[model samples]
Target chain A: SQQGEEDPQALSIQEGENATMNCSYKTSINNLQWYRQNSGRGLVHLILIRSNEREKHSGRLRVTLDTSKKSSSLLITASRAADTASYFCATDRRNTGGFKTIFGAGTRLFVKA
Target chain B: DVKVTQSSRYLVKRTGEKVFLECVQDMDHENMFWYRQDPGLGLRLIYFSYDVKMKEKGDIPEGYSVSREKKERFSLILESASTNQTSMYLCASSFQTGVSTEAFFGQGTRLTVV
Candidate 1:
């Protein structure tokens, strides 16, 4: 089953604008991660935020997690036209006895230069 | 750098034929997974192996089986291919650190069943 569901099935913005994508999960998660996929390629890991961590940042990517609300958001600052791709949020369910990563349907971001 | 390599970037097979998709990881990770990505389905886990010779089913494991005889290699087998099974297959590997770690994915295999 898909644990995470990303909001805004699609988003389009100017290259200099910031893009935000939100994801909501069904159950408690050990950690939430964001990935980016370009066209027909595989996904590339972006950032991961643990449940105990309210916010985390890497480069221009900032991820915020709200355990109580069961949602997380990814914000890309000063987006570029090269950032046009699909973004996915994944959740690792807590205490499943095994490691299983569930992914969401994903949000397609189109950046216009 | 951790690298996961899928055997093929594209494959074409006939319906009812047995198909095997091979994946190899160079990082010696303990966990390997198979997922299928469709148009609107995102990604659905098919199977995962935590250790050599041990396997577990994921959300969608009906027409698929897995083999992990070696630490670096994992294979996904389709008993009988069908047109419905045509999708992008992704293989990933991650460390078994008791906590969920980052996963490295291959380029994916675009399988077409006709």
Candidate 2:
């Protein structure tokens, strides 16, 4: 089952613009990770934020988690044409050592060169 | 590099034929999963294995079964293929949640059942 739902099913932006996408989850999660998928390829792991972490950053990618609202947002600063791909948010559900990760529908981002 | 490898990049099979999709992870992660992705439905879990010889049914497991005889190898079997089973299949592996939350994925296998 899909635990996360991504907002803005699709987004388009110029090369230098910042792109932001939000994800909402139904249940408590131990951590949330973001992945990027280029056309006709496998997904690449981007970043991960834990439940206790309100915010985290890696390079130009920033992730914010709100346990109170059961939501999270990913911000890509100074986007590039190469950032054109589908982004998916995954929730690592905190269960009895189950280690199950549920993925969202994903948001497609297109960057204009 | 850590990796998950799928047996094929594409496959064409006939309806009512049995099919097997194989995935092997060199990382030796404790958890492995099989998911199917459609045009817009996103990735839906078909099954998962936490340890060798152990399996759990996911949201959509009625038409599929999984085998995990070895820790590094996990296979998805379609007892009887149907046209509705045509889709892209993805395999992923991750360490125990406490160790790492990120999962590494394999290049998906595009299955076409006619």
Candidate 3:
């Protein structure tokens, strides 16, 4: 079963606009990671934020994690047409012996030029 | 750079046929994972291996079996392919066991069972 859920199944934004996607998980996690998938391709690792950390940034991507709320958000600043793709948030949950990472349903973002 | 590669980009097989999906990684990662992606169901884990000759069942592993005979190669096997099994299969590798670690994924293979 999936441990996380992402809001806004799909989003459309004009170029240069900022896009935000949110994800919520069910259990305690050691960290949360965001991924991007292009059409018919595999997922690309975007950024990872540990539970102890609150915010992280990579290039134009920003990820914020609130362990207290059990939720995380991904923000893309100055979006471009090439940034259009599916975004997924994966949660690493502390289980019995080893941890398992569960992925959410994902949000599809379309950046119109 | 770490490179994860899948054997095929697309495949078509008849129902009841045995199918094999191969994945290879050059980064000498310790963990490998198999996931199937559908329209709205997102990506569901089928199997994973932490080391050579060791495998673990993921959330949806009933119809799939995995083999990790080598450190750099992982294979997913379907004993009898069914029409419902037609979906995109993705392979990924990671270097660490913790949740904070990042994973590298292959391009994925679209399989069609007819």
DockQ for every model, please.
Answer: 0.73, 0.61, 0.70
Which pairs, if any, clash in model 2? none
Chain A TM-scores, per candidate, are 0.96, 0.95, 0.95
RMSD in Å for model 2: 1.3
Assess each prediction's global lDDT (C-alpha) against the native.
0.93, 0.91, 0.91
Q: Please provide, for model 2 over B31-112, each residue's C-alpha lDDT reduced to its tens digit, 9 standing for 90 to 100.
A: 9999998877778889888899988887799999999999999999999999999999999998875634688999999999
Q: Report the lDDT tens digits of candidate 3 across residue range B1-114.
A: 999999999999999999999999999988888999998888888887878998878899988899999999999999999999999999998876655479899999999999
Identify the candidate with maximal lDDT. 1
Model 1 stretches astray by more than 4 angstroms: A94-97
Can you tell me the DockQ of model 3? 0.70
Candidate 2, lDDT over the whole model: 0.91
Query: Candidates' TM-scores?
Result: 0.98, 0.97, 0.97
Chain B TM-score against the true chain B, each candidate: 0.99, 0.97, 0.97
Which of candidates 2 and 3 reaches a greater DockQ? 3
Give stretches of model 2 more than 4 Å off: A94-97, B97-100
Worst 10 residues of 2 chain B by lDDT: B94-103
- lDDT per residue as tens, model 3, A1-113: 88888988999999999999999998888889999999899999999998899999999999999988999999999999999999999987554425556789899999999
Per-residue C-alpha lDDT of model 1 across residues B36-86, encoded as one tens digit per residue: 999877999999888999988899999999999999999999999999999
